[model samples]
Target chain A: MSTTEPDNVALNGPVVGRYRVIPLIEKGATAGMRPAVASKDVQEALALPGTLVADWQDKAIKRLGQLVKQRRGLRVFLDNCTKCGACTDKCHYFLGTRDPKNMPVARQDLIRSVYRRYFTLAGRLFPWLVGARTLNKALLQDWYTYFHQCSQCRRCTVFCPKGIDTSEVTMAGREILASIGLGQQYSQEIITKVKSIGNNLGMKPRALADVLENLEEDILDDTGVPVRLPLDDSRADVLLVTPSADFFAEPHVDGLIGYAKVLHQAGVRWTFSSQASEAANFALFTGQHDHMRDIALRIRNAAVDLAVSRIVIGECGHAWRVAYSYLDALVGPLDFLDPAHSRVEHICEVTHQLLTQGRITLDPQRNAGKVITYHDSCNVARGASMGQRAGGQFRIPRELLAASVPRVVEMSADTTKQKTFCCGGGGGLLTDDMMAVRIKGALPRAQALQSVVDSDEVTHLVAICAICKTQLSSVLPHYGLQHVQVTSLHHLVGDALVL
Target chain B: MLGYLLTAAFVWAVAGSAYRLIVWARTPSTLPMPLTPAPTSRVGVVGRLLLELLTFRALARADRTTWLASLAFHYGLLLILIMHLRFVWSQLPPSLVPFIGLSGWATLMLIIGLSVLLIRRIVIDRLRYISSPSDYLHIILLLTLAASGTAMKRLWPVDLYGVSQFLQGALRFSWQPLPESLVLVVHLSLVLLLLFVFPISKLLHGIGIVFSPTLNQRDAVSAQTRVLSGSSHSKTRE
Candidate 1:
């Protein structure tokens, strides 16, 4: 729909190539590339269009009606957007892909147009005039292609005049897609694993226990002290819920080690619960409240069973948002716990607090070799809070970096803090199937990161979100920043923690 | 007959707006999803909204150019509307009497704002690409109305006393002769068109922003848990 069709040169160039500006696409460049959803996964999740319902069009419309009737923000977001384009260039995907539909307003219009044609008075009367479109196979295909392209980063929301969050709109879009059994395989599979196995990786209690024990042994071998990674200990004071990736994946696992060392240093009795091993809730990515609630209940159940006074989440971006913002609301009345402390906390906040009170000594000299910069995770920056203060989410991580790292560098002003760009791997687009868009969507972040690398020989890029770490690790290499090591904020904390 | 038509248009605008708002209010947000770094108190929420309304705070941060032009347009319209209150109210506070002298300038400010917005829409790639036929229509409609109003002020001045008497009479069910000027007729007709489309078109954004959950929800103890239901549809269903 954009009048400015992208030049063919930009379209053919490598995603990492230096460009004066990313151009907007004409059409069909991305329309054919849709994330596939397995029918079996749909059936298992009990989401709609499970191959049993051949009439996906009706099921989709019915789901849309349910969302419009239920979500207050969705109703306003759908009905009110004046298409001001305040958020047009704001989305990382739009900047990367140059797909006009990736522009927040145009993306919302994908569903907004359909919603209008079926639901609104003007749309029903003058569909073309109001830019309303009747739902069809081709449009449904566009839903998958473009909606998945969005990382649900909410960078656009910070600048929107109406405060319409494109993440919220994309969530609703994904939810509607899920309803008709057309959900993305990456997120749907993760939700299935989480629903059945308690973690996104589907790691069982025994394997998780083995992983923690191995980490403890490794920590003990590295340092003479007996640092512990307690597994499912009922007597622990804090129930630490972290992403399953921390148990296996590099850098993430290091962040997990950082949490263990911090908890150990503070002498706070904390343990990981096998039953609620993952903090990154894929339900959020899929945008189903019921699914999110049912999945999140495992965390509460784990806390109740362990009888922990507090729940501290490790470095996972969307998980932090789900916990810090949505946890108490999703499954609440956490009255059994102590009233003085918040029910859920970020590991960075815990470390920051300990650093503030001098409970733990951090030797920033330990990280002397690296020039560091911190990347604010989308969900944490825009969707959640970390400490008692208002902008603590932004402050706490940087404060930790300041306390624990010797030399720190700031990125360009507009691209950090509330204006931070997405790492292009969040909102469940972390799958290999979505690699093209992930690399493309990462253009803004790469540009921002590439700037600091040139200006100040920044060697290390630290992030607090798991998806950001993983996404950046894979995508940054394309931009010739393979030398810029993307590690966790807690991994930095873990490195700088003194015996 | 014109008075009755105007009354019907106003009623349509009001009722349609109320229906939309009621539907929005009735829909539960299910979770506290305030864009973070938000106000923690109800009073703080009010303060945030006030800042946004009075200054277009979010717009200002997002795009400075649009923000300045929008401010010129909206505040100018506010001033003009205040001056126009004389037609509906027999008299206003004497302090406002001083501002009435500036209505012509206010109208000029509105035209200036509308013109810039229109030019930006045409010139900017991102805006032009995302813009639809309806967006241009909305601008053209407002620009035409503003042009007509400006014409009435300088080039084709209307019978002000008669127009006021007619509007005032229409409100109280008393008949007054319609003002006999083409510019005034065009301006009045455009006003009616705007009001009629207020609830139907993107013009509803004025009301829509008030109910936007991102703008209105509180971050303080974000666990307003009792309202968050997993299957709200089951509970809401008749």
Candidate 2:
């Protein structure tokens, strides 16, 4: 991206945060983001209170106490923040809304205030001094409005001096809300679908099979090969667990096609299971440990049932974060599977390995007209990894882009790696209800993209995460770069794969 | 006696910080939530954390002004704390005696550091909004402490031997006359109050950083290696 070094502000160098990254004091820009439709009766599945109880405040506090005791990260984050403001402007929501509460530290304070009142000695003695507040209906409302504003992207965590990840605080807040019979409809419904129908769209086995069949026919028409999209194949060597969005949505489905083409070219047998159909775990958004465990178990069960040796997580950001970072803890050990492979594998890791070994070749000229820049999805960049190195998550996608696309331009160094911005719609905030937050949140990425479009003449923007694709596509036009459409990293790969 | 007040503050600060540290360690980490591009090894994590603690490196990247002010304040605090060991310790370790001589300039550094932080809190709307009354009180308290400490250092010129003897007596539970200077009394009283509030206030960040999952965690996530990484991951609720 062409970073504009404003002469007045750029005293020495063009800092990444020179323009529009700083919060401009727009109070209530995000305050009215609205409570997402709370889930109905579905709370029973998560063993939550079925409805708002008379003792809802007590229930929420009790749940917070349980979470603090159960989750050390949450307890420590609540205790550790110094209000140094390192993370004050780090949140995209805060940048977008300028609502001070949208700031990560302030958003965290929504619950930490309650934590102080109940748990800390200073808050109990002199609540005003520590910004502590007792539980109340109005304050609980603030908990929902502000915490939901967070995408749980972990962007703020990167810059926090204490490394206090506000996402953990947001997750804990959501968990407390659910305990008091308040839950996000978007996340809860998705979790219920994964629990009941095996996918987020509630796509029954027949529907999923039909979609795969259509995808296979499309691949055959395009490539003139009998490339198959295998479903529940018992003889498969790899189990491909991907977000259902990739099975149905544009750009996302192209990534699915890319996976199949690569697997077919590499001569590796892989299959997708309707049972473990969803790689995107909504339980992560809800912060329900038991539900997160149960959802991840479906993958373990599917691997066992399908008799696959390896499980490859698809190109969804948060899904990869869960699969790579939390799968072992959530689903127990992978001893049942083959030991030669990693316990959990990212789809990009698998594809990168193939590209490295010359198992497949790409004709970069196939994407000749497109100048591309990669958007490092937040969850994968900060919450997950690829290859064997620490920053492999950032490297592998760009490497894939470079190998597959002819003209690849790097976005701002600041916004491309661990400092990447969220796609606004992650953390289960991808529903229609949070459109305002989504649009505002997309501003920083949109500006970064506009700079690239102006300087590098970058035409196509590509990202690995499904949420980033969908969010960027929907939101970029609002910022005047309507010509820029977000595509999948593997879409380019599918385009360039030399048959 | 002032000894009892000093003892209470010492015991509370140590016990409170330790108590929070212990609770953080005991609670289940549940998942590996390392902010990535994170170090993949324990040594790497330590090195990165040390850089952050020592330099406020992340703040340098996020906001340069905060980093400069914070670096000055914290390092200044460290140096000033060490300089005070002249009064606290019966005798300085032979090596530290050399560094203690830098206390004159370190006081200026401390005042400058605290001033920038205080001014930012007063001027920056964002910081002003995020800061509580106690945040202001903290800066004011520390600034006043520095001013009074400076007055004793240069203006009042209290009996150094008597003050050192008084501190040693407080630690040993054998009282000694605290050099009978109003400035010394003001400085010591503020120091005692700071210690008493350190653990209860946001100052817990001093200890909490060690147990912070995002900072202390390694980037590598293997189910088999989960034990070494997430130490308290045993699921008790389930």
Candidate 3:
């Protein structure tokens, strides 16, 4: 294969450099990968009673009006984009797919333009002149095609001069689409599963108990320690509400193993509640506020029923964001939980404290074979904090990694911390149909990881979010760096824990 | 006739701005969407807003060229606004007299800043793609206002005493004939048009920044225990 000149690389195609900058393209409705439409069963599960309505367009317009009245962020964001282009180059999807519509400002304008035509005087008088368009069938199709492209990662909000959050706009657009009976099948299906089976994967209580039993057997055989992964034990001091993926997915299961080992060594009494086994709430992804509240209420009820004083969440990025930021607001007066400790604590925060306080010891040499780097999952990095400090989400995880690993190298500074890129599989776009979007969107992150691998001999890419772990694991091979293993931050901790 | 139009524009601008503020205020922010490493206290939020307002700190951190142009444009407008106080007040404050003389410099800065911003929107690939006709029109309008105001100041000087008398008369609800210079008339008309559009267009960003949830909300989630509404879940949990 002849290598093309770097300068000759097309703007709308991938570039090879220190970091690959994907060229801009017009990836409209048929971008080779579109999310499946939400089925009727999924609609009923989400309590969206109007899914079968014939007048969806009118209903959508009315729903948009109601949302604008309720949410100040939606109204203000619709008004505030000066289109300064600061956020144009900031989106990972824009960087990866090279689609201009993937740019945060343009993505927001998809809905903003419709809002203007209906709401603003200028748009009503001269729609074409102001780039405003009527909310037609074409516009709604664009909303589905483009809004799904956004990971709802708020990286663009950090650099925004007006602090206009595009995620809020994306959520509003998704909500409007859902109101009119159009919803992405992935998030909708997951919500239905969580509502009925108490987890996204729909693994029943017996399956969950069986997985825990197998995990216990493997841990005992390997580590010579009989660490119990207890379930529904009301007497426990802490309740662990983790993503269902931790019980099923590969690297994610290892992260769960780490949590079990840390809890075992710390001598803390923690149990998983079967009633609220899953922490990942896909309702947030679909912007169904009522469904989000209903899912969170299950956790609150479980905590009350179990009489657990403190609730600790596992390594799920958006789940932690919901737990830390929105849980209290949605279903709270969590006054029953211990106020001295955070009502909900990240598993990393707990493990980091244990390591620092000498309550749990780790031998970094156990992980000495691998040189590691951490990917700041966008939701946890920008949307939530870990400990009391402002950027504890970024710091606490790295601290745990450094304590557990022999050597650690950070990815490019621009691509880490508050300005981190998404792992291309968030915001409920992790279905098989959206594989093309997922792969292209992973380019920017893959390029950043590639840089560290080339220079620092980094062997493993660590992530805290299950989606990130799975996405990176699948996409890293396409970048010609398949040897680089995608592992979890807790997986390393578990390896080094001196049991 | 020109005096009445200017008065009407000013009234519309003020009333429209009040309505915008009321709309924003009436819409409740049910969730705390503060972008973190955000301030966790009320005082900290004030400090954050002050820094953002005075320096455009966030923009500066994101892109320096845009930050410099925006900072110069806003500060230049502030200086020109202060100089306009000479028209309303019978006796200019002694401290302000010295700065009023710098109107020449302020005018130059305003034009230069507007030109830089206009050039950026025109030449930058990303910016040019996003620019609507109105975005360009906004800058063009401001540029014309700056140019006409500057020409009247330096090239074809207007009767300042007569203009001030007309402004003072208008303030006191009395009609006075506007200055008979073409440059002065154009300048005043342009200013009126800007005010008319200020509350209606993206220009509402001036006030929108203060109410920005990300910039203004405190990040004190741990301190406040949210009281849920009396929904079925509340009773079910109990």
Candidate 4:
């Protein structure tokens, strides 16, 4: 909110009216950083000039240069391409949007040009010779727009012979752009809320407590069962958490209802804490590593404080990837969190196991007559090694979908395992502001669904990721798709619960 | 002049490099994976062909300025290849002789342009930051090949007729020994080096991009564009 004048392209500049913006710290160059004054007043702030500046100067610059090298290196992926187009017919978004640029090769070239100009000999010496473009403000905007269009989905890599990862490039682009202070406002706003209120929804402990109290009342009205949605209860056996969207939104709330019903039926000793309740981390989308780490820290600390046995994540896709892939490395060896006491399971996986064991009877007809198809969230299916594993762990979602709706059909060119298209929302491009790309990016998936709708008369779109659900719901209508309601895999379980 | 043994080796090396470049340029032929089938029909085929020729990438608009320089380098490189080809025939087709001579002169200008460009990469700090070891090696390779090949063809034409006859005999598989020459040796060595380096380095992308999922995608899916600028997308505060 500070309206201060911005500073130089390099080195320390003026802080936005209040906080002092330190010189862009160069990695390996040990630039000294003075502690920010606790007081908000700018003039009273202290400065640690010479030594601090010198420390980080060379190192930070070197790191930036290294990033440029990686960008330049990606061009090999660009130039060596055979244009055989083997993977073209495979992308779900392309089927959905009909845009040529959505294809993986075209998508990567945008980022590759910047890499060439700054990193390659030809691009550097004869900048006009090798098609290398300089990275300026306008170019930065194009990258942000185009990179966001990719959901960090690994579908292209699965089809690619060399396994070139567009997601990695998108992440790199985000970080490089962020270092230059060119982050999007929507993601930035959410990060601000996470930093200030401890949750992406700006839900502090007290606000979350109120929401839980209301949720308990709603559960009583729906099932006539007095279920207590516990908050901040210490020493609970299982710590269950979900995206804030579920608590306030439709059908997702029903999905939450299903979760409560399962816990009660099984007599599982699980608790939901208001203090660290959010499972959705938008920071992952914006490439805000520290923000993501902070969110993870709160979750870990809360679980440790309560002495929970296992942490079960609700039906949020990328959050689970961040949890499974990064949390252990980023916030753990939580010697404090006993390994035996801490395990993360996707809700669908847990529910499917419960059903397979015959602990819960499923009513097949509850979801009857709905020709249903499933959209694999990129994080769980593509980025993570969950569905791709050779044995049973990967097949859990497919089996559950089939069992729930007897009419489950596979989406076209759908990568069941490591290959999956991003929902155009994975990197946090899910909001209405990114609707143009979401509309285009979702085309491949929608087109696949349309085939089922026309040929098989499918009616429902089942998804495991909340972002995918949100994105598909908005995109389907644009294509004249009907009655294809998007809901979590578990909500279907709650419907078929044979109580 | 070196012995006939060196000439034979030099000719063999140049042939190998030409084989590699052609393979690198036309990677669709050796594909180990499934092919997306090049777009069919007059419009699609013509569009596809043009894209192939120009390496047309919409996202590459940033490199619009480099088009002329790249055209010069590639055109020069292509011309030099044709001149070498003319040597393989005993009697140059009367019509092609003038074209070959023009291409020989063009190669000289291209080498000078490329050298200037390579030096720029080394001197510019921003450009230097991202450059890799192979990038420098590639520039050196091309320039060296051009310079050496130009010298052999225009400056020193020692036993030019005998060299042409030797090349024709090799092409015919008669196994004739090549005429001894230093410029030809250096040019052939550089060309061979470029070949061995192709598969391992970024040069590999020349074959890889065609199979790039983005370009080859058969689906008509459009990715949604972002409404917000990246500069405003700060999700974390340091």
Q: Candidate 2 on B40-95: residue-level lDDT in tens?
A: 77899899888887877788888888888887888888898888888888788898
- For residues B121-187, write the lDDT of model 4, one tens digit per residue: 5764323433555567677888877777667767986677776776666555565555678776676
Residues A91-166 of candidate 3: C-alpha lDDT, one tens digit per residue: 8778766677888888999988888888888788878877788888777777888888889989888888898898
lDDT of 4 by residue, A397-479 (tens): 77876777667877664434443456655676766555655664555455566677778888787777777777777766765
Computed on alpha carbons, the lDDT of every model, listed in order, comes to: 0.81, 0.81, 0.82, 0.56
lDDT of 1 at A46: 60
Ranking by DockQ: 2, 3, 1, 4
Residue by residue across A242-343, what tens digits does model 1's lDDT show? Answer: 888888897788888888898888788778998899998988987888889988899999988888777788889999888877877889877766555546
Q: Please, what is the TM-score per model?
A: 0.94, 0.94, 0.94, 0.62
Better of 3 and 4 by TM-score: 3
lDDT of 3 by residue, B1-238 (tens): 8777777777889899999999998899997888877777899999988888788887886787888888888888889999999988878999899888888888778878888889988987677777889899898998899899888877999888889888887667686898889999899889888988888889988678888898888777744543211111211232
DockQ of all predictions against the true structure, Cα-based: 0.38, 0.41, 0.40, 0.05
Show the lowest summed lDDT stretch of 10 residues, model 1 chain A. A1-10
Compose the digit string of candidate 1's lDDT tens values, residues B16-80: 88888888789988777787788888998888888877888888888888998999888888898
| Model 1 misplaced regions, further than 4 Å | A1-26, A45-47, B222-238
Could you give the CAPRI-style class of model 4? Answer: incorrect
Pairs clashing within candidate 2: none
